[model samples]
Target: TFRVVGHFNTGKALVKATCGRTFNSESDAQTFLDACASAGHVVSSIETKPSTKKPAAPFTTSTLQQEASRKLSFSVSRTMGVAQRLYEAGRITYMRTDSTNLSDVALKAAEKEISKTFGAAYAFTRTYASKSKGAQEAHEAIRPTDLSASSIDASREEQRLYDLIYKRTLASQMADAKLDKTVAKISVSGRDEEFVARGEVITFEGFLKLYLEGTDDEDGQDETTKDMLPAMTEGQPMTRQTVVATQRFSKHPPRYTEASLVKRLEELGIGRPSTYASTIDVMQKRGYVVKEDRDGTPRDYRVLTLSGTAVQAETATENAGQERGKLFPTDIGLVVNDFLLEHFQNILDYNFTADVEGEFDVIARGQLDWRAMLKRFYAPFKETVDTTMEHAERASGERILGVHPESGAQILCRIGRYGPMAQIGGPDDEEKQYASLLPGQSIETLTLEEALDLFKLPRTLGEMEGKKVTAAIGRFGPYVRYDGKFVSLKADEGDDPYTVTLERAVELIKAKIEADAKALIKVFEEDETVRVLNGRYGPYIKAGKLNAKIPKEEKPDDLTWERVQELIEEAKNRPKRGRRKKS
Candidate 1:
């Protein structure tokens, strides 16, 4: 069976298109291709079925964070912080919780509010057993302290969070949304393949009147996305409106957002809801992970379009692998992870952290002997650490790339003093070259080709001001060197040292020169060391590297050499910023 892509159209109005309904093969699909999507296919069958969508469970700590992240664009810590403020103001219940169970009074309040606001039919009081057995924090799910007012008069963030909690709590006690789903099976003129068109009509709003759960995967199509099918008989002929098959690629596992990361930890029992925020925060603080919005690279993919019994192939580009507010592992994170996995695989196992967490919980409840639990884990863990320290070689996360094509020097990618970098030739070699790995390029994933590409830098863009202008990657990052002065290549300007054109490099060079010219006001021709410059605050005097502030009352040009020296001495002797002079 082959999954072919196309659309179904009646011509009156655009109804639907899909990557749905598999055809027998490519040849069968091409037998009756429609370029304008005007080909005819008989409606073989139509079926409508009733479906009910249950309201999502009331907000647990993790669920709340996940939803807030998706709906309000709040980070996990931000969500927690806002919820905490709401709780403190007595607008909502405690922010931290694992239970989905609503208190008896809270449930009654939700029931009353749902009945009054949405009518008696919508009020279907329901109870949810907490999915997590080891529930932490408050027993009740996070909810509005008073359900009568779904929204509160507060700061925007707090109000938004409270509204969410209120709606979730109220919706949890409401009836399921009723839907009528219709599927039309169309028969191709010359093939056994069946063309399918789907439509869904929401018959009753129910809990949907208040809230719909936010999804982590935003690209996924939902049942609510389809419209009502056009009135048609089983034997009626239908014209295809739009049918284009854009290639779809399999996606890698998504990087974790703070909320999703919390959910995962909850699922694995690795950490409590209270610690989830701190756990994510600590990784970033330790430089193990970065929470950033990365503008993903663009790539081209093939497109197959069927127009009037003919297929047209073309290429289209898309921003691929784009991520927003996601946690990405740094180069050091990978290196450290690799080292830990090799030296202490047992301790690094996911189950180990979860089991220890459970053990701690047991100790807190006085069910397990705390000392006994620690002794069991500590003995083996300590032995492994000691043994590994003594016997294991240092882990640099080094990868020996193939020899350079021309020089035949062995290339290697590894963590150096500054950070992860590619190196050519070892210590014994007469000469060596090194280049720092580009941002988002990890030592573990750096390919030999990519590593070699790094060495292509230090490129000569052309001569400027009688000096050769060259761009190269350095310890700090990519920069351009000209006339004994270096200018960093700004990432925001989309400058890549390796691929920067001579024109762009010259533009940057000129911009830097213009900025320096504006900054330097005057030079002491006699001393050659002292100069008047416009610093960040205002005009200042510079003698070598030392800076002395030029008082507003005294003009810099009016100051004599002795006065300038006296001022410089005064600046040097004055109490350093953030320091104190002895009384």
Candidate 2:
């Protein structure tokens, strides 16, 4: 429900109700509307107050990562990596720290810098208290090593990170920003319902002048709070232009981004500053979660086009396909999460995790025995693991989707060794044919109709030049087969092998043949032939045995022979990975 202020029918300003008040039923609503029409309303009261926003504390590791993710679009790992480089170069203090307390030397430097840059009025000398329960007071928060060394020669990414740190450190020593808030209570002439409107304006910039804290939302300020309200006194009459009653439902919690997840982990005391980036990295590397592009729009409604007219209808389910970077749990991740909850409840418990973290802190402070703590935790955990290993059922991702209508066989969706797949026969049947689910289909939500649709695989697209041509889904993706020659289908174009026509299949096969014939990109002046070809992991250029990945910023066709040679050399000189020996 919303209320707006505007001109009324009469030249004299007056408050009026527009939409019918909500009730238990339509009849009740009508009765209320009739009552409101007979009655009247007036401005009851108004209040204006002053509010102030205090400056945020100096950067902790978690807060720093959160800010970088929100403002610079930097991943937590990337931010830490650049910060580590800066720390190593003596440009910043230790990056891995939870304490918000600043050293006397650092604070004095910040005071000098703030006073010199923004004048004495903007300087704030009060020290901030550490909010973290486990913060180490011995270590200071992240700050510049030398405030005067603002300009430094660094990489583009390092420069941005340095700038952020410098501004944030200075802003931490600034005054609070002042705001004026106004709220009005308007009574309808004949209605019992009262409408409330609120607005606020920033009266003093203060710390906001140097830096405004970033939020998870792209817009740092709330729309309602940012709006400026006109001056009004108590009992001043207000004209209601319109009253809108919108049927709004509660929204589902948003998916976690890197910043939000770090914040949550910190709140729960699940991990320390140093482990935050590694924890997220391990999740992605193990395929428990995948970073993918998603649509930013939370689709709460579906637009239907009928008879050339578009109508928007509210929906519970969101539509797929929005472009933004976010992390999503895979089927395996869900399975693992459920399995851990069932078998290792104590280990996976939030309180248990936090308690263990507290125990580690105790050990760090030399107040507890580390070995005793480990022994107490390990005994039950080992026993549970041993018992569950023998009894727990394997989550093979198998689900019976009911019997097939015509085949009389049961349709089953399961996660095979490769990935999620569906079959059309019983477990003992040797002749069961399996097919992978369509790109976006999920086993959890697979219906009988959708499962049966998978049986239409290895589709024959008719003969091409007297040779039989077929299209089907392979391990990689959709492909067309003609006379034993397999041609991969490109979705960037309007091609889907699942629904490709005979003519399209023939054309694709021809294109594949042409492409294969010219795999050699160029014969360089150094007698090196650089060939661009598809590899197990996307597309790359091959010079001898060294393969160079095509950078996202550079197109394959735009590469020159010299650039190819340089890329090949770069790939050849790349460092090899191996386990590090403990010192």
Candidate 3:
């Protein structure tokens, strides 16, 4: 049964309570009441009038930060700290809010005061109204609760907050902060760049009276605001104002502080007014977040920078055909992302995420079938999960390439630029040069040391003896070798660099093969692709090559040339096997 507390002009109660039951009309409600009455039930009604209690002044420093901190799990101290600065420094309206409203009387008083303070033309013709919806109707917007409020004297920390709120409230009520906004959009080459400036000319001092007072309260005012700007009109063109062309790279993910987190949560629609504080608290406790400090010392810092997004910020932008950086995903996040991207790709779809959220809203209002909706979503999502897991082994093998932020290069080097590559020395073959050589087609002739020494290579090799097609070889023997080819170790490093013999060419090839082998060995460790086999030559019998025989026995044991030969024979004896099943 439902009861009505207040009635409307159409004879419908303005306030009604339905006691967990549905009512289609007044008649239906009447029938239920009649039934109850027949069964010995009694009903009564009461009338009350609304009262007019002045709401508290607009949010004050502590109050605003407290509410924001609680909703955002921001520390109380952090709330006041930022708010006080915003208030006294004039970055925002007063930080604290306690006043209930901006009195019509106060509004008129402000207008009169502004007209007297500045020229009458500078005063606003109409009152400023804050129609921001869903705000507590009785409470005032976060503004100066009192226009006549004076600058606060600093005695306690709380005074700082009071000063910020007071000045902002007065500032808001006095006038619109005048700004000489300048914007320039220029095209260079094929790209376009925009520059903007928010400057002021001949600032109306009336609003700034409160600003100045507040500035004194928070901290000393800076020189920028002390002088009035030169006057200028909207259409008038100004001088360059010192034009500058600066180079900048794409920015990384911004570090999140309490203030920024609140902003982001508001943007995502993930939390409501009452739940923000709890969310922040939980995040801190979970070890998923920490406050980053400016000087390595924690000085009332409250910003939270997610360790993962740090990587994502890199490789976000680049020139064409570049490998981007990988956003370091947490183990769990990586698994979830991969699974969602593969099996339930639709779940990753923006439309699907939105539709599901919308359905929840409908369910809350009983406008949609809850179980039916659940089933509809569960079926496809479940199928996708199953399919993903079934093929997880194969899917995990795929690699993704992205731009590297630091070098802006396609290849990623694990070690620093000075790290070695596997190679044989050619021109500058020093002792430390052994580790830097690697086998790959080069754009220029460079030794392993030279390549590693220089972080990057020129597009083409400039002036080097190795670049000449025919070079004379003397001392060791007469030989002619191509300029771009790797210098053969056997090549006579003498007067005649061009002339080379067949013996020298063979020696060079052998040296090249050895160098490549050493490099490959470094890449594969014992834990990775390493296996020991018996030597047919038997323990370095001489500085000569020897062939190892295949062994018998399919079972694993101590490796020997005889055993390897026997195992090879056994394998040949067995029937051929088919491929193993995938996944």
Highest lDDT model number: 1
- lDDT (10s digit) by residue, model 1, range 120-146: 999998988777646754567888888
The residue ranges of model 1 lying beyond 4 angstroms of the native Cα positions read 1-28, 32-40, 136-138, 239-246, 292-320, 404-407, 427-432, 445-476, 480-487, 494-583
Show the lowest summed lDDT stretch of 10 residues, model 3: 4-13
Best by TM-score: 2
Badly placed stretches (over 4 Å) of model 3 are 1-158, 179-200, 206-208, 211-247, 294-583
- Report the lDDT tens digits of candidate 2 across residue range 1-583: 2222222222353333233234444334334434433444445777779888888888999999999998899999999999999999999999998988888888888888888888888888668887765666567888889987666799999999998988888889888888888776667675567665567788887888888777776424653245565555666655434332223334456678888999999888788889999999999988788877865445453222111122222334554345466788877787788888888887888888788888887899899999999999899889998999899899776789999888688789987776778888997777887988877677788888888877787898899778889889877788898877888888999888668899888888888888776654444565545677665575688776677888978877677878887888888888987999999
TM-score of each: 0.78, 0.80, 0.32
Query: How big is the positional error of residue 543 in model 1, measured in Å on the Cα after superposition?
Result: 14
How far out, in Å, is residue 55 in model 3? 22
True-vs-predicted CA distance for residue 311, candidate 3, Å: 39
Clashing pairs in 1: 34-308, 35-306, 35-307, 35-308
Candidates 1 and 3, the one with greater lDDT? 1
Superposition TM-score, candidate 1 onto the true structure: 0.78
Candidate 3 local Cα displacement, residue 47, angstroms: 66
